[model samples]
Target: MTLPTPSTEIRPDLVLLAGRVRTGLGSAADAAETDGTGRETLPFDAVAVRGRHIVAVARRADVDGWNTSAAEIIDLGESTITAGFVDAHVHPLSGAESRHNALMLHDCETTTEVAERIAAFAAERGPEEWIRGFGLSFDMFVGHEITNEPFARAFGGRPGYLLLFDGHSIIASPRALERAGIDGTRDFGNNSSIEVYADGTPTGYLIESDAESLVTDLYPRMPVEARVTAVQNKLAEFAASGYTSLHQMNMEEGDLDVLRALEESGELPVRVRVSPLWRASDPWAETLRRMIALQGVSGRRWHVEGVKFMLDGSIDNGSAWLFEADTHGGGLEPYWTPSAQFTHAIHALAESGVPTATHAIGDKAVEFVLDAVQSLPSHAANTRHRIEHVETIPDALVPRFAELGVTASMQPIHAFAQRADGCDMWTTLLGRDSERAANGWRIADLDRSGAIVALGSDWPVEEFDGRKIFAANVTRHRHGSDRPAVDPHQALSPERTLRALTRNGWASIGHPGEGVVAPGARADLAVFADDPLSTDPDRFAESRVLLTVVDGQVAHRDSSLA
Candidate 1:
């Protein structure tokens, strides 16, 4: 099972991971092999790393063949060594900011409960301090109006702003609206809107990026030092959870400066590939030129290489571009005023050798993105394209991903937002029992269709725990919820789940050689307390990440190992 090595004469700094190893070979046939005995004889027990690259994958008995004079070797008893998980979609700078500055309301089940948490959070802060909150689920307002009425008394007239869990919308208190001078609705030139009542009284519900930005743009920025530390701490959490690289789907205003700050101190924890968003209202030609110029923009451990387009927003917030309007009479419009502009932007990015990752959550948005990619010239075929959040589509759209060579970057963990009885915001909007609701998060369907199905946490929306993401894919169960699994038929097997999290993540980015334990690959590996391919879903989800190695250096190690 040992791979051929150069020779013992070649001595290099080594990080030998000892345990069961998933060596990037196709998992099913390569899971086990034997020499006329019951013992597994497939992957070598250890993979040796030298200077940010794996030097050799060999058995433990061959240690004396090389001089082991100064090598940091970790002996993980029975842990599983595999390619470190890659998050295909994330929002680093913004997620870090929310984790540090805002009160979290994700766990609150009812509006009253949310109000209590907000009131408690605001009570502890000075009146001058802005009342901020994130992860407010839309389901709490299902039967009630989505206005500031429920939480108004709690904010106590402070400049309060709350971000919806979907990230496409916000709920602004009266004082907050006044602080931003948003007295009435104005033209955003797209689907973005400020919700108002019969007499043009602002209802404090802001939908889509343009409308949400009106209030968010006025919020105070964190100090540079604070931002850097916040980001660093969050990436550390990612590494500890077994993530080695993240494709940050959207870039924020000061992302470059914050990333530079981390790079200056050599504190950037994991590799991040950032893609700046192409806002709908931005001048098309000018923005496309700027985005093309931003490709390959790099720091020590991060780069800007792709553009993110929002063909539409989230279904939960009723901003998704659906074929049929939701029960609320929303979801028929694309984020872009005319969907054709999105297609033009896609074509422009592709022709310039720039890859694109479009945020398309609904059926129409996904179809439009696929149509745009299909319409590209043959010369543009070499450029990579990814469709993020393919939440739901009819049967016909499933196989188009493979045919078009588009990477399907999905977050199976997002099923947590749904209830068993189809009462969650997303399900209820699409007619609780509709076929579209039943088709949400088709991880298995796309994977079976031969698409490069890359999985991600979509952190800040979902928590960045890799185990939860992995388990959610297979178990089909919502995190910590007693409800039945969402569309159990769409669940992925454990083997398929690992590949989607690892190999396909790199393949989606058009890098075929990475995300493996082969000798010449990058030295990014994860050591899990349980085999990531374990059949016991509950145990796997709760398993600890004993150690994580990045660039031949230990990014995380469990205290238990020490």
Candidate 2:
């Protein structure tokens, strides 16, 4: 597995010396170059970078044979090079806010631990500053209700707002409730409720959309300049984790303006595919005009590719819009607006020649999205509609995605993190017999049934770590545990997992040659400290990104390089 040595006469624009390279291959022509050994054989010891493109990748032997003048060379030193990680569904703004505003609860094992952490965080901040935190789990608090009493006591008079890890529930203190102007009477749809005691006092616990909306309204968003700085910091974090590009899900027009400003000022370091949130109240003509006007806005740095639509709520909050109530007799309700409203919104987006990516979590919600897709005229295929978070799709509707040419954009880490809760929710909503068919991240099964699977991490909602995500996909288990592993037969191979995170993400958004390392492709690549393909899941999880190059520009590197 030795790379060809660099010849004294062979010079390249840039050279990346690595132990291995994993070229993202989506077709047989790309597949033929690698033997069944799952490794790439290159003739050069380095990759030559010219301006913002990779001019040549050659071994030392061929470097003298090709033009190498005016090139920059990087030595990887026994590491591996692969296509940069591309996250498809992320809330960059929220993720940035989480870096500062909220108490991070990503790995707490119990509710008491969560309370203690919030209490500690509140104690350190000034009295007037809002105490906001994220990543609380509903399942963790199942038996013990999330009352504001504990949070209020912990806050010691400071206002506290704790967002459930799913981002669908919120536990607010009495002060926060008063600040948001929400009383016990607010209706949040389904079992969605603003929890108050029998005394009619606000309980500080809000479920589903009501709770999420309250926190959103109460938290003073950062100014555009601050947001730009936060996003820039987030980009560095992403690059350090081996990502060179990301598709921002649910972006608003104002957010796009901020991104444009950053790009114009040469502050944006990563490529972005922006999907604006779509509302029914917007005039179709005006929306289309604005979308068309945004074409070529950032000279390939930013793209407005589609519209994001919410079809239903999350599974964790018991608002997933199931076909039936929970068998546990808790009166579980579906978390969607009226069916008529959803149908109208989907039709409008489809007819406007703009692609739509609907967030649907429950089987019933998936059905609603599918029905809407089926209702579209045959010409609607031109829009390339996608169903995001198809977490609990019915077995019967699985093939329909392929038949309709829809992309199943899913997050594999969600399955690993939420599997127990999701199964419990499904079993409660549908009977145990029905639970047998509930599927999560059935990658091979979905692809076999004719679906195009793309990967994403709903960042800030949950921590986005690409290595952990990829390891979860292949190992089907969290690190150091064999318990709760997914069906091994349905797990994806390491190579396929890489493709889903890279090329499939690009293809999902209508960008073709962006994720591969071949000639003529955008020079978006990540260099790792070890060969990811040969490493075990634990080793893969530990693999550090040594360098990130986007459009042939060095965006991130180990601190040692500085």
Stretches of candidate 2 above 4 Å error?
A: 1-12, 26-58, 144-146, 187-193, 197-200, 252-254, 264-267, 279-296, 328-336, 418-437, 480-484, 560-562
Best by lDDT: 1
Q: What TM-scores do the predictions have?
A: 0.97, 0.87
Count of steric clashes across candidates, in order: 0, 25
RMSD of each: 1.7, 4.3
Q: Which segments of model 1 are wrong by more than 4 Å?
A: 4-10, 35-37
| lDDT (Cα atoms) of all candidates against the true structure | 0.85, 0.70
Which lDDT tens digits does candidate 2 get at residues 1-562? 2223344344445667676566664433223244468766542335665556655554545455566466665667778788888988887755685557667877776767877998888778898788877777665654455677766777777766888777777888778888778776566444467777888877787876645567557677778888778887887787788888887876643676677667777845678877776543345567656655554455446677777876667665566666655444432344444566667666766677777788887778788888888888766556777888887765787898888878888887776544444443334344444652356556778877968788888887755777877787788777655567765676788878888888878877777666876555678889888766668877887788898888888878887656
The sequence of per-residue lDDT tens digits that candidate 1 reaches over residues 52-164 is 98888776776666666788767888788889999999887888986686888888878899889889998998886788888898988887779988889899878888888
Best by TM-score: 1
Model 2 scores a TM of 0.87
- Window of ten residues with lowest summed lDDT in model 1: 8-17
